[model samples]
Target: MKILVTGGAGFIASHIVDAYIQAGHEVTVLDNLVTGKKENINPKAVFYHLDIQDAQVVDIFAKHRFDLVNHHAAQMDVRRSVEDPVYDARNNVLGMLNILQACVKTGVQRFIFASSGGAVYGEQVTFPADERHQTQPYSPYGITKLVGEKYLFFYALTYQLGYTILRYANVYGPRQNPHGEAGVVAIFCRRLLDGQQPIIFGNGEQTRDFVYVKDVVTANVKALDRKDNEILNIGTSTETTINEVYEHLNALIGAGMAQKHGPAKEGEQFRSVIDYGYAKKVLDWQPQYDLQTGLKETVAYFQ
Candidate 1:
């Protein structure tokens, strides 16, 4: 199968690009190099250094006649979205529409979307929100993701396009950008490796469901063959706190840094976890890495 992986130069999509190549699929990568790094792109895949909203994207689609589009490119920062929603909408919403239009024009069969489990649920009423959970996205970033899912649904109904929406939890592993506001695991690991004290926000009790990147890649691989036009949560049902994450990374890196506290950013979700039971049932997928093991691997990568 010929696949176009948007944001294939980024942390998560780069891993997915490698996996797709390993599975003997022809791959093409489209990335603007905004947040995505060129070094992360797989050499085996054809590379396009352009944004998703570019008019030339249609040319790429028409020329290649791609079988599937694995959409991962977006304005992923929650705080950044809060600061400038129009910018977020332009990138996340309008950019995705551009890709979808190309997909439609070129007769692309399927779209595998990378949605957010944490932000889409907002302040969850349930301990571990499932696919059925009500969506009350707190930030413009989350709203855009939810809107993306809805757009996919519309496309599926109108154009007969198949889609699988994978609502991912906090994905962390090797290739994760430590400088980004989104990836706490990468940030803490980098800070600890540099012998700097990692800051804990809001008493360190805010929890997130951190899934490994490799596990997420597996789900993408499975989505290729799946015919279901459905939405699924891709996360471990367990919630781990920020302090616990820091402790794990600190021990793994042998940094022995003391906990430093900072004021919690407003509108940050205090507790976020998603149930992947439906994913297990449908995709035959379950998270292979526990937090401890995943953190150790992450630490090793940083070292």
Candidate 2:
């Protein structure tokens, strides 16, 4: 199968490309390298430095006949979205529409999207948020993701386009940028390695469901085989607090690091967790790596 992965040079998409290539599929990566790194692109896969919003993107679709399109490109930072919503919306909402337009025009069969479980559900009082949970996005980033899913649903129902929306939890692992708003794990790991104290917004007790990138890759690969066209939550279904995460990383780094408290950022959620029962039943997928194992691997990579 010929697969096209948008933002293929990114942390999560790079890993997805790895899985696709290992499965003996022909992969083409379409990325502008804006937030994505060139070093992350797999040598085996064909690369095109193109933004998802470019008009020329449609031309590429007319040229290459892609069987699957894994859409991962977006303005992912919640804080940035809050600050410059129009800018963020143009990139994520309009950008996704451009890709979907190409997909429809090119007759692409399957689309696998990287949706955010973190922001889409907002601050769920519940521990495990399922697909059936109420979607009231607190941030523009989350709103755009939800809007993309709605568009995807419409495309599927109207145009017969098959898609799998994977709502991912807080994912961390190798190649993750510590600079991004969502890369708390990577940021904490790097800080701990440097013997710097990590800062936590509000209380250090803010909890999030952490899923490993490798496990995310597994879910992506499995989506290739499944014919389902539903939104699935990809997570461990366990909440880990910010302070606990710090301790875990500190332990891995062989040190104890205290966290500094700061004012909570706008559109920030206090607690988030995703229920994976639907994913397990539908995709026959479950998380394979725990925080300890994944942290050890991620720490080694940073070291």
Candidate 3:
């Protein structure tokens, strides 16, 4: 199968690109390098240095006649989305529409979307939100993700396009950008490595579900053969506090840095976890890496 992986130069999608290539699939990568780095791109995959909203994307679709579009590109910063929603909408919403249009025009069969479990469910009514959980996205970034899912649904209904929406937990592993507002694991690792104190927002009791990037790639690989139009949560269904994460990383790195707490960012979810039961049942997938092991690998990558 020929696959076009948008944001394939970023942390998560890059791993997926490699996995797709290893599985003997032809792969093409599209990344604007806005947040994605060129080094993260797999050498085996055809590379396109263009934004998703570019009209030339249609040309690529025409040329490649891709079978699957694994979309991971977006304005992913939550704070930035709050600051300038127009920009976020332009990139996340409009950009995706352009890709969808091209998919429709060129007869692409399936779309595997990277949605957010943490943001989409907001402050969750349940401890571990499932696909059936009510979606009341708190931030504009979350809203955009939900919008993307809805758009995929519309395309599936009207155009008979198959899609799998993977609402991911906080994915962390090697190649995760440490400089960003997102990717807390990477940020903590980088700061500790640099002999700087890692700052924890609020009292550091806030928890999140962290899934390894490799596990996410596995879900993408499984999505290719799945014909069912499904929305699945890709997470461990377990919560780990920010302080606990810091302690784990600190132990792995032996940085011995003291925990630093700062004012919690407004609109931040106090606790976020998602159920991956549907994913396991449908895709035969479960997270292979526990927090301690995953963090050790991450620390090794940064070392």
Candidate 4:
């Protein structure tokens, strides 16, 4: 199958691009380099340096005539989204429309979306929120993510465009950037490597579900063959506290730096975890790497 992976230069999507190319699929990578690095892109795939919001994307889509689009490009920062909602909307909403419209015009067979499970289901009432949980997002970033899912639903109904929405947990692995729209895992690893203390927001009891990037890539590979228009949560259903994450990384890196406390930023969720049982049933996927193994690999990358 011909696949076009947006944000393919970024951490998670780059790995997906590699896997697709390894599977002997004709792959195209599209990234603006805002948060993506050129070095991360696989040379085997065609690379296009363009934002997803650009009108030029239509031409590229038409030229490639891609069979599927794995949409990962977005304004992913929650704090920035809260500060400038219009900017976030332009990228996450309008940019998405541009891609969706192109898919319809070019007759793309399927679309795989990378949605945020923690962002959409903010401050979960249950321990691990599933696909059926309420979507009461706290930040504009989360709101826009929810909006993207709704747009996919609309496209599926009106245009008969097949879509698979994979609501992701906190994905971390090698090639993850340490700055700009980065997760706590990357930031912590960077700080430890640099011999600096990593700040713990609030009391450091806040939890997140950190899924390995390779595991998430497997789910994407599985989604290609699934024809059902479905939304699946891609997570380990295991919640780990911020403090525990720091401790694990510090142990792995042998960084003797102490943890420093700071005031929590706005638009931060207190607790988030998602159940991927539905994903296992539908896509035959489950996370293979646990936290310790993932952190060890991440530390090696930084070293």
| Clash counts for all predictions | 0, 0, 0, 0
**Lowest lDDT 10-residue stretch of candidate 3:** 220-229
Q: After superposing candidate 3, which stretches have Cα over 4 Å from the reference? A: none
- Tens-digit lDDT string for candidate 3 (133-208): 9999999999999999999999999998899999999999999989999999999999999999888999999999
Q: Would you estimate the TM-scores of all the predictions?
A: 0.99, 0.97, 0.99, 0.98
* Top lDDT prediction, candidate number: 3
Cα lDDT of all candidates, in order?
Answer: 0.94, 0.90, 0.95, 0.92
Clashing pairs in 3: none
Which 10 successive residues of model 4 have the least lDDT summed? Answer: 175-184
The per-residue C-alpha lDDT of model 1 at residue 303 equals 90
* Per-residue alpha-carbon lDDT of candidate 2 for residues 1-303, written as tens digits (9 for 90 to 100): 999999999999999999999999999999999889999999999999998999999888888889989999888888889999998899889999999999999999899999999989987967799988899999899999999999999999988889999999999999999877679989988888888878888887878899999999999999997546889999999999988888888888986666688887755788898999999998999999988899899999998
> How many clashes in candidate 4?
0
Residue 271, model 3, lDDT: 94
Q: Mind sharing the TM-score for model 4?
A: 0.98
